[model samples]
Target: MRISPSDEFLADLERLLLDQGVAPDQARAAAVAVGVEWGGQSVYIRLRGPYLARAVAAAYDGANVGELATRFRISRAQVYKLLNKANEADRPQLEQARLPGT
Candidate 1:
């Protein structure tokens, strides 16, 4: 199936928020807010630190590192770092899923 750039971006953002422990409803709301805010801006608004890392990581799943780097305007190394951070965040969940009861 095909997805528009805007839809892909929003989906990536939502996933990033959700991975960071935001509730599904809140993630969608936050993604919408981000779109609205950025849509009205004439200049670029840079996202940094952990938030950017998470966003890049989430986007990586749907896109390659090169695409993510271009989309987020970062280097490949940075993308790897972000993806690594995201993986770290998922470690606990991964461990839980491996448990017998789970």
Candidate 2:
């Protein structure tokens, strides 16, 4: 079965990386690590006020997905993925509104 990333999951992972001073690409891998599911692994993220959430949300508001990707330093594929996950079902929550350190 193919794996899909949950918006909440990715947001939390991003916050964790931000807290640890990790790079986005590094955080990408870590995000994927948790985003993947196949049993055995058991971890999840519940972000609040995450950077990507607000950033992506703002970008997704009035710009094309491609443009948003460039602005965020990610690929089109990643942008599309974020867009889909970020729709109503993936809107940032109050609990998921914080970064790692702040």
Candidate 3:
């Protein structure tokens, strides 16, 4: 199947894949190959999958991936995966906690 992408989409994918050590040409190729187009022809394609968790863990003051991974007692890969899931599940709780009456 073919896919349609926004200009920003391709750029973002290219950047993320390359940052993950995917070779330039290979990153472009892989990002191109891994994509799905929706009814409106918008595509959501990613090479590194969910990275927000890794980013969040790293964002806490003075905390890096190694530190967060150590705290979690898991390989860096599992930390990324679990953090991704945790961010999603925590959103509702986060919103509730943020409410004025909370």
Candidate 4:
């Protein structure tokens, strides 16, 4: 299956919000809200998925790992694993977030 442009746009908006210094949870929630409004739950879930949750956690400024594990319904080990992968997957975003003005 292929991603539609709207799906891509929503994902981009999430990243943009994060890059612009919006809280990770807020950015993700905004994207999910827009996705649901424009498409539906299935579309939003399909596009965002567990990986996006992991990414949001990674970008999150001070998230507690245990709490994140509980919230995302994953084991702490899995959360650490996914966070590592997410950091690698979106290294540029991490870098951008670290920039002085961001």
Decide which is better by lDDT, 2 or 3: 2
Order of all candidates by lDDT, from best down to worst? 1, 4, 2, 3
Q: For candidate 4, write residues 1-102 as lDDT tens digits.
A: 999888898899999999889999999999999977877545435533666556656555665888776666768787777777676767888787795976
* C-alpha-based local distance difference test score of model 1: 0.83
| lDDT of prediction 2 | 0.67
| Residue-level error in angstroms, candidate 1, position 36 | 15
TM-score of each: 0.48, 0.33, 0.35, 0.37
Model 3 lDDT, full chain set: 0.64
Identify the runs in model 3 with alpha carbons over 4 angstroms from their true place. Answer: 1-5, 35-40, 43-51, 54-102
CA lDDT, candidate 2, residue 42: 55
Candidate 4: regions farther than 4 A off: 1-63, 92-102
Q: What are the per-residue Cα lDDT tens digits for candidate 1 across 10-69?
A: 799999989889999999998898788775455454676788988787666655989988
Scanning candidate 4 in windows of ten residues, the lowest lDDT window is: 40-49
**Ten contiguous residues minimizing lDDT sum, candidate 3:** 35-44
* TM-score order of candidates, top first: 1, 4, 3, 2
User: Which one is best on lDDT?
Assistant: 1
Candidate 2 lDDT, tens digit per residue, 34-88? 6575234554534323566556766675558777777777787877666666675
lDDT of each: 0.83, 0.67, 0.64, 0.76
Best by TM-score: 1
Report the error of model 1 at residue 25, Å.
17
